[model samples]
Target chain A: MTADVQTLASESGCHLFSGCGFPSPGLNVFEFKPIFSIGAFDFTKPMLLALISMLLVIGFFWSAFAKPKMVPRGAQNVGELGYLFVRDNISRETIGKKGDPYVPFLFSIFFFVWVMNVMAIIPFAQFPATSRIAFPASIVGIVWVTYLVLGIKNQGFVGYFKNMMFPPGLPKAIYFLLAPIELLQGLITRPFTMAVRLFANMFAGHMLIVTFSVGAWYLLGFHIGALYSATSFIVVVVLTAFELMIQALQAYIITLLAASYISTSLEAEH
Target chain B: MDGAAWSSVGYLLSGMLIYGGIGWLIDRWTGHSALFLPIGLVVGIALALVLVFVRHGRSS
Candidate 1:
């Protein structure tokens, strides 16, 4: 990664400001060298960002709810609003009334993902940790396991598969054609799409931002290119605003889907 | 409701992937070019449609 950066730097002849050539950002931007290593463990920028996001989520909620107030003031008031947002808007809307029990799970996933994505636009920390596939993949893995367990526990092992694969009103002969597809949908594609959806959104948003930001800075070098540079800078601003909406929407959709999956698992039949 | 809709999409994708994947393997084995690939893909889409309609389209 550093080697590519060096090549671009020399190619442009821009050690600080030497040429008007635009040096495009690529996959190398995503890879970060470890700051420090303890045995097999290596701490990198995204890892640190992810850790900070987790801490921010925990700290914010803990501060807001540690001491409950009768009338609610300051942090408690803000905390209640967030709580209700997840409960009423997401859980109740998607999973129905009984989804209240899973509100905490949904709330955590939503806020954690939101904060991680929002990091992309933050001034100093401009990279979204969720852009890395591992984060979303791991979270979806947990979600997958949670719903699968919930289904098996609520219905007997055989009953769970029976209900899932054999929906009523289907012809007997069609079962052979449908069962494998249904099983794949339930067992594999559900989680696969969940992970990819979040990862792809963040990944593409970050890349777009980098492309414009680099173009703007690169074009600023020549007097003749200044007008185009300003145009690129304007695009960067617009894209940043768009990224904010996408970040929040992706978080909400993932949480909403998670709740829906849990609710489906708890059902006696599909 | 949204879950059912997304589940429909998931069904279609996975069905095509699984069967189309099998067809690709068959084509490779026999060196028959593209004979089973389209067949697999159509069958996959058809089965996925049936699964979606049964699961989400019908009124219980």
Candidate 2:
């Protein structure tokens, strides 16, 4: 019940890398140690979690898709549905006809995030890698590079900047202000916002579960505590369901944004 | 419960702002998102380092 969330909150930070504690030495007592780091490469617990998530997602789907059947069943159906869902909703809709070539890339991003988010509320392994900003930022960075390079590759230097800077339908008089705003937004805000969106959601979600779970534990002590404790039990139950919904929503959002980038590029410049 | 007792919200918020701020700066300069990959790792570690020093600095 409260065990998994607790494990994640406690274990994630300190198991590897070293850091400071909260509430002081004998009080708040929370510190995370660095697992290992070089220049910018730190292998921490969450890093391991991220690796496992990628491996698990790829391995399971690979097995499922490895042997196709006339009529898909069990894991194969589940895996295929996951892939098809991204293909139809995200790739097809956002990028439209031109986005077909990117189906595999879109599918990987969607399903990978989908599975990582699913890990959070699954009882024993109640952890979400995206809760670590580094994790989501990495993916966002990758996606940003892909579209950015493509935008430049296809449109060329001045053309790519022009396309991103000035979208199709804008007042000519305002292109000066709007162009810088657009360029800046793409360069600075877009990927960070993308990473933070997923990171903030998962980070907040897991923390809520942990806080309330701990609150419930402490509450079981007496009359008020017990009453609040029992109430929290119910709250956790309801929140868990909502959290699952948010998990899927986050994955969809990431995939949708990726496809939208492609679609925007394909449109004729204004 | 692992290290300190600060509000989780405070730590997370600070992390978000600092990491985002630093990442933004790197993006502006390098024009490469890869610049952030290592930077985040550094900032997170640096944050931890600061935490270790801040409390210890006060304690002594």
Candidate 3:
């Protein structure tokens, strides 16, 4: 049987007093059966959701900006608001004047991530694609390449490593102890932590929602358990609302970090 | 700045991982269970703090 609580609930007809133990949701909930297979590839639910999110982002922008009025109305107006939000709050705040060129990149990342995260709250598509590590890892991979390339391009190859590993004004002797730390932090830890931060937040959020939802379902029955079920249901609702805010905040945070990384690459500090 | 603050965290964590890892290797090489691991961790944290101070502490 699928790990989905609703499916298990209907199939087993188990309730709090039914003598069967609670079918608590676990890590199994995150795993999905292949919707289809093509040679070596197995297309799953999260993959399908991520694909939809990308198309949604692309389609929205296309319609919004396809026929631009001198003064925007309808979708164009909303599109301008989204674009300006990223430009002003994220890109400009982080990268200044040079940030304008990168606004589209940050804008796309922000909205695509936001939509993927919001999928958690979306009925029937309750899983956030980002809760899966592969999605965030892929995004971080792009960011990793972008900053590394930009750093090398702006500072030259040797100069980039020099700036990253050997900050000026430090005593020569200390560099021996500190250079490796800097290298590790810059080259590996930064991107690793970025992906972990987004993935962990979504993963934990999804787990919490699933656990409470299953608890509620299992507790529902003709007994005192019904009241407990009501309480659990309330918690489920509250956590979902909290997840909504977290989804948007995570999107903003990742975008802001991306912009700052790009900015640091553009100009090396002494 | 938020970026500066967040990167400081990265610095601290990398410091621990790099040194802790080195310490672990030393332990395996020397046939001791936990001698250098703690020493490495302490040194790592100290260096990380110093790095944070140098980079973000004194903003002219």
Q: Candidates' lDDT values, in order? A: 0.85, 0.66, 0.90
lDDT of 1 by residue, A164-223 (tens): 888888779988878888788889999999999899999999988888776665666557
> C-alpha displacement of A182 in model 1, angstroms?
0.8
Where's the lowest-lDDT run of ten residues in candidate 3 chain A? Answer: A1-10
**lDDT at position A266, candidate 2:** 60
DockQ, per model, reads: 0.77, 0.02, 0.82
Mark the 10 consecutive residues where model 1 chain A has the least summed lDDT: A1-10
Per-residue error for A53 in candidate 3, Å, reads 0.4
For candidate 2, the C-alpha RMSD (Å) to the true structure equals 14.4
Error of 1 at A180 (Å): 0.6
Give the interface-residue alpha carbon RMSD of model 2.
16.0
| Residue A8 Cα positional deviation in candidate 1, in Å, after optimal superposition | 7.7
Candidates arranged by DockQ, highest first: 3, 1, 2
TM-score of each: 0.92, 0.70, 0.96
* Model 3 residue A117 lDDT score: 100
Candidate 3 iRMSD in angstroms: 0.9
Fnat of each prediction, in sequence: 0.78, 0.00, 0.78
List per-candidate RMSD values in Å. 3.1, 14.4, 1.8
Task: Using DockQ, give the best candidate's number.
Answer: 3
